[model samples]
Target: MNELRFRDVSVRFGGRRRGVTAVDRVDLTVPAGAVVGLVGESGSGKSTLARAAVGLAPLAGGAVLLDGRPLPRTPGRHGVQMVFQDPYSSLDPRMTVGASIAEAAPRGGNTTAEVARLLDLVELAPERAAQYPAQLSGGQRQRVALARALAARPDVIIADEITSALDVSIQGTVLNLVRDLQRRLSLSMLFISHNLAVVRYVSDLLAVMYLGRIVECGPVDDVLGDPQHPYTRQLLASAPRPGGIPTALTGAEATLDSAEPGDPHHPPPGCRFHPRCPVGPLVLPGRDDCRDTEPDGAQRRHQAACHYAAHASEQHNTRSTP
Candidate 1:
């Protein structure tokens, strides 16, 4: 069973004139005890989406359901918990680490000893529970936050860049701990990160987002290994590879099959990827609309909003324009 689900959720800030639509129509389902990854760049809406999952961010539009129930407009028992990027910001500076964990003890951790036990689960000595957030390193502080969330025994955990702030060595430890914790506790996780490597390490299913919408999504292996979406391909090409040759993604050429937005409510006419696409120079470089409008980053099974993707396999194989 899926523990958490987002149905065409949309969140926008400010007005049409100035505000940015942070999260566009997004639909995601996270299986109970499954580790799903939500990966994207800084402005790609990963954090906003994660915040929505945890009930910390208001939904400008659409529905968010937890275990088949509508989530309350406010944060409450949907058994959802979040581990933020900066452990220090999430943890209190004034309270002892133990005290902080005890306060949010998810399962009603009633005793100090139980709190210590939570620390043990996260691989902490439980003695460190006596220290404050300032006393612990970034990784250690995150463990404390994890322990606190574990105290609740949450059914769903939204880990938002919890390891991004840590050193590489510490990050590996924390990542392993998260994997171990999920296996032992059967906790469902929506792991959010911009790092493709990290996402690959943690997620079973992967979602690639651009702007505020999901551009492509599929099983981790399929999306990373044989990405069908042009954007996905671009990302893979840009990331480090075995030979370390950076396969550059030039703009994409526009094809006729692309979505055409008749009204502004619709995204825009032709392929959403026509702009900033590498091959656009050859296909429809003369067409200027691709430069004027915003593409709705919507998806249906590794969906590529590029019309050229209609011919991506044939066209992309060529790499450069003829």
Candidate 2:
């Protein structure tokens, strides 16, 4: 089993002085054979992190490690492969599906057989290999993309919003195939998505990102069941619930009227999230701790990078005391 770790990874676009930091000091691990779902809003750096793993994006600082060692920057195959979000654009329009998968196969092998096996691995009909990208449906194209990634025989797969572009009716089928493939192949994955329900269904562990930093991470059940950070609670509250019932967080704290996330090029001081924090100045009024001091990323079984989460835990413990 291979473990993938991002050690304080940071990705900056353009010049260092005025560039936007897409991923900032992110520390995350996809444990051996475990699926870690990364969730956040569209601009939260989830995809940027994935790109960094595959060497598509240059790291401004830090390293991406595979099994405790740094991944090779010069890539043919660094034991990590990425399946991008848009199937329509990800697959080449001119190439046949078989040709696409075979192109990623290791050289000096029976490429045809490998392509057939990969197609079957992704649950595609073997004959579909001859079809062009335009000939396949959205879901089929995605499956082909998965097949192409698998052809590299990678230890870790970075799935960057792989299901978001598919039709709703076909999303479940694709997700199930991905889950099944992971178990059958004992693959470690960093699954990126914005859908809480989808992440809950597919991931064993979850990491929440906001403005290029991880705000919370833990076992999926623990984080989703008892979210620690106010941002996490706000995300959960806004998610659609079964039977149209509201989530545990209700009223003012759950409201989305807080300030919008700041520019990545010029993030706010201290916590970085203080401007939009529901439990900070918005609720506590005179509290400057959130604005004046950056909170360390919580280092525990279930982690949350918010001072208020720690304070709220202390308050709860005090109330429960004799």
Each prediction's Cα RMSD?
5.1, 2.9
Query: Model 1 compared with the native: what TM-score?
Result: 0.84
Residue-by-residue lDDT tens digits, candidate 2, 79-132: 999999999898889999999999988888888889989999998989999999
Alpha carbon lDDT at 85, candidate 2: 92
Prediction 1 global C-alpha lDDT: 0.75
| 1-322: candidate 1 lDDT, tens digit per residue | 5479999899877777767677878888888878988876567788988888777788888888887888887775548888999999999899999889888864543568988788889999978978999999999999999998887767899999998888988899999999999989888999998778888998888888766777677788877866666667666666776676665433332332232322223343344444445555335456454455444434555554444455564565565446
Q: List the residue pairs that clash in candidate 2.
A: none
Worst 10 residues of 1 by lDDT: 255-264
